[model samples]
Target: MAASNSIAENIAGSPNHKMLHGTLQAAGLVERLGGDGEYTVFAPTDAAFVQIPPVTREGWMLPAQKQVLHAILNHHVVPGRIDSAELERLVDAGDGAAILKTLDGRDLWIRRSGASYILTSGSGNKAVITEADLAQKNGVVHIVDAVLIPAT
Candidate 1:
């Protein structure tokens, strides 16, 4: 990906975004998150959101849920770009564990298991990085298989 494209643009340009673009835009977070400096967004695809319980996802889409949506999205972002190699090094220096501060003002624990990287939220919810090192202008995105929910 080129540095000119923001994380949202990169995702929107992706084939996967076709289905979720409207939802993201409707939520009013597209513009704020899109076209900014480089950022690594652990974006959840439409399918991933589908995996969420229907009622839960519905509740989150409500106008009152804006804060929650922002929190969830921000949880997926870290201030600076952190690639897998640097993450690995950090984990190694920390004895296979490191803490990543999210944009949501929460701490996410990163751990290395063999060759894989696992992210654990303060609530103990964990998600593994299924795809890493997706370079974007603002930062790098590491695709995760599951969503991480912070403790309420």
Candidate 2:
């Protein structure tokens, strides 16, 4: 909640983002992501992760699947401090949608859905930003309603 904290600190402190923190930790990205770097994250909530099959999700956390997990998480992050206003401006500039390059170099489409901001992933899965503009020391976080699939 405070701007003094880093993105990882913010996620770790949030009740809705515990699952994301765990995933980051599992992927060996906790230290890297938590370090001094700007990142705009489309963070999925616990409920969103719950939608994935338990076995499949559990397997992703395995040590052997660290690269896969890292890639998946990277798909949800952009290397900057893009907040809600900036995202909206980008959408407006693009006339309806904006293409955001994820940390993994995948394209993440953001479009306006009335008052909500919808994100479409490369796998065609869509997610809505349920909560936005969570500012931190390194960047901002936007809590999404679904886990936007990564490019295969």
Candidate 3:
């Protein structure tokens, strides 16, 4: 599973995250994410990306949109490793919901949805944690079903 690799390395090697890997490269965030620091990335899979409107998706890839893309990517990352177990504890402590501060200086609310969990953005966009807790050398990655759009 190459659990010893950094978050960016693992994402780059993952077949399901090809689009995300490329986007990170375009956003110039690969180096920082791969460096020595604890991070939790709610990575959207290739399939999840397909759900976005083609034109909207393509626009984000433009050179002029690099900073915008970076913000979108940063919205998915947290400062520390908040694995599923820890998320559960936090949710319980918050009386069924917890506000996690994202690396982009925004908040992401996590709530229990039956047996699984879901993250709701400030804009009200919801992304279910499809796959959780893929450990890496510096942190972990969780695959989400949808792109989490942060509030403007």
Candidate 4:
């Protein structure tokens, strides 16, 4: 249909982007990802944030928790643009699963669950790709159903 925007701009335009935008801004990563790159961001939707306890989410938003927020957010980002098709291929090649290194330096397990894709966080939390292949000027975005907290 229409040309896609940068990841930051795309997030800004979505209904579920508020919490993510806040976290990105608080982490000081918005400007970085806003620029051109072949990045892949597994963006969690607003509903995904709801899965986190309110107090936990509140704590993460505090200035004192900036580093934690940054790490958590970075865990959702993988370098290079990985679209759904490529991801599927990777999973297929890996026999239904593939390990992806995130910007935070932890591995995220991507697997095929029936007709959809599932992302297993380092902490063992699982999120589904509710929407995929959101093409952006910088890269791509996959709207996920949960926030991926890295294992401690």
Clashing residue pairs, backbone N/CA/C < 3 A, model 2: none
What digit string (tens of lDDT, one per residue) describes model 2 on residues 1-152?
Answer: 67898888878888888889999989877786689889999999999999889998999989999988998899899999999999999999999899999998999999998999999999999999999998888889899989888878
For model 2, the stretches where C-alpha displacement exceeds 4 angstroms are none
Q: Per-prediction TM-score, please?
A: 0.87, 0.96, 0.97, 0.96
Q: Which stretches in model 1 have alpha-carbon errors above 4 Å?
A: 1-4, 17-27
Clashing pairs in 4: none
Instruction: Supply the global lDDT for candidate 1.
Output: 0.74
Error of 3 at 14 (Å): 0.7
Candidate with best TM-score: 3
lDDT of 1 by residue, 56-95 (tens): 8777778898788667767777877789898988899999
Please identify which of the two predictions, 1 or 3, would achieve the higher TM-score against the true structure. Answer: 3
Which regions of candidate 3 deviate over 4 angstroms?
none
lDDT of 3: 0.91
Top lDDT hit: 3
Tens digit of lDDT per residue, candidate 4, span 6-122?
888778777887899889988999887888677999999888998899999999999999999998999999999999999999999999999999997899999998999999999
Point out the worst 10-residue segment of candidate 2 by lDDT. 28-37
What would the TM-score be for candidate 1 when compared with the true structure?
0.87
Scored against the true structure, residue 48 in model 2 reaches a CA lDDT of 92
